[model samples]
Target: MSVIKVAIVGANGKVGRLLVSQLKNNNSFSTPLAIVRTQDQFNYFKNEAGVDASLTDIENSSVSEIAEAIKGYDAVVFSAGAGGKAVERIFTVDLDGCCKVVEACEKVGIKRFIVVSALKAEDREFWCNIKGLREYYIAKKAADREVRDSKLGYTILQPGSLELNKGTGLLQPLNKIEEKASNNYSINREDVASFIVQSLLHPDATVKKTISLVNGDEPIEKFIQSL
Candidate 1:
């Protein structure tokens, strides 16, 4: 099989960092193009992670500018975020930025797009009731909608509360759970990153599907195949 060249937006973020690391370790994926917002971020990925990177301020860049930056890659990962509680920044980075990435991908004829979204984004009423997180959810929901409606082959992974602990390489498809238990939620950041790389490598895992993720007993590959 031919290797897939991927451009990771927000490659400096926590999950992005792990995704780059995992991709480097896997032979199926090419050395990812780490997309960041500033020169400093580009340097960090180059010097620290030894990955090729470029600067594209997503908040300000037009669809064409973003598309130009990611022109040759086979796929793009939309993991960039504002990383704060600020409402405006949330919309800018999560909603508008995600839409731009999708539009850019479509413009360039790159059909494989992966997005990391929050759990329960589909349930707006639940998120809106939770203080301080309404804006974030709103942004994610909007971005997710855009991807779902687009013609691109897309996978939206909606992992629950994220933990910084080491990955277990195990997970459960949320749809498989018979009961909507809260304990079924929550997954390690490392596992989430691994899943993203696995999903890219295994296109059948969750293509054109939005999956809810949580830590569970099933092996990652099996779980993905079952989906």
Candidate 2:
């Protein structure tokens, strides 16, 4: 139960920002390392957010370089993504970027890895028909597979449509959710961030598991116990 030093790869994103704040405020964790792609982001996380910041672009940096940046951290979280309609970026940032992070973690001997992936990415039939999102899901599926196949203790969180609502600190396992037919699965980004914290805190229960997330009535702590 020592203080865990965490390095978050996408600290500038919505959920990533929330994670940085939560981890920083928690006594169980040391200052979280924010790995960002630009100097502006680096400054924000370092001078403003008061956390260690690394200017490393996952899409451009070599695996060796990334390993160097993340070395000595107890865990690494891969939440970076190419957020937009740029199809080419989906391959570079979403796919190759994730693979490189996995390689970097392995090289550095960092075993605790968490990934933020899309819901239903495992079911190709479900995402393939969704217009404009097939490539993103394809990248996510491949990235998820790489993590599962790696030697690290990995947890892949697949959350449904992300929303901006306040986090209720509550969740429901995908399989237990009864409104699957409605196809309106979604969760707040803050809730997803909370779940990541819970996963990191309870690796024994979450390691090697890919859990689907959606906002519900169950508290995060209790929901994690059920995992």
Candidate 3:
């Protein structure tokens, strides 16, 4: 089979960097198009991660401009985010930016799209109870809705709290979680990248599924296959 070509938005971010690294090292995926906003980011992926990239300011670009930037890739991953606590950025980066990505993918005819969302984003009660996280969750929720509504083959991964630790290669699909049981909510960024790679290489494993993830005892491949 031919290698899958991918375009990753926000390729300089924490998870984006990891995803670029993993995809480059793995044989299943081709060297991805690392989309970034600035020269520093383009250099970071080229020099540090050793991947090919393009410069496109997603927040400032139109949907058509973004679409042209990512054309010719087999798939796209929406991993961009606004790192600060800015309320306006939540809408711009998380909601509007992702919606633009969806539009770009649709225009370019790249049907395979993977989105990295946060856990409990679909839960209105969870958003209401969380302090100072409502806007972020709201943005994530809105973006996820747009991806699902689009006419594309998409997998929406809603991972729990993320940490910058080593991957365990183990995870728990939230659907398998026992009700009312205390679950470990933190997951390594590397593991999340691993799951995205697996989902990309094994479309049957996650196509059209919105899965919640957390660090658990089941091996990553096994858990994904089980889904």
State the C-alpha lDDT per candidate: 0.89, 0.91, 0.88
Task: List where candidate 3 sits over 4 angstroms from the true fold.
Answer: 176-184
Give residue 199's lDDT in candidate 3 (0 to 100): 94
For each candidate in turn, the TM-score is: 0.95, 0.97, 0.95
User: Best lDDT goes to which candidate?
Assistant: 2
Using TM-score as the measure, which candidate wins? Answer: 2
TM-score of 1: 0.95
**Cα TM-score of candidate 3:** 0.95
Clashing pairs in 2: none
Model 2 lDDT, residue 36, Cα: 98
| Ten contiguous residues with the weakest lDDT in model 1 | 175-184
Writing each residue's lDDT as its tens digit, candidate 2 over 1-227 gives: 79999999989999999999999999989999999999999999989999999999998999999999999999999999999758999999989999999999999999999999988789999899888898999999999999899999999999988998898888875557657436567789999988888888999999999998987778998888888
Which lDDT tens digits does candidate 1 get at residues 1-227? 79999999988889999999999878898889999998889898888888888899999999999999999999999998999757799999999999999999999999999999998798887688877888899899999999999989999989887889999998876665534356647789899999898888878767899988788888998888788
Q: Where does candidate 2 have its weakest 10-residue lDDT segment? A: 174-183
Candidate 1 residues lying further than 4 Å off, grouped into runs, are: 176-181
Model 1 clashing residue pairs (backbone)? none
57-130 per-residue lDDT for model 3 (tens digits):
89989999999999999999999999855899989998999999999999999999999999878989877767
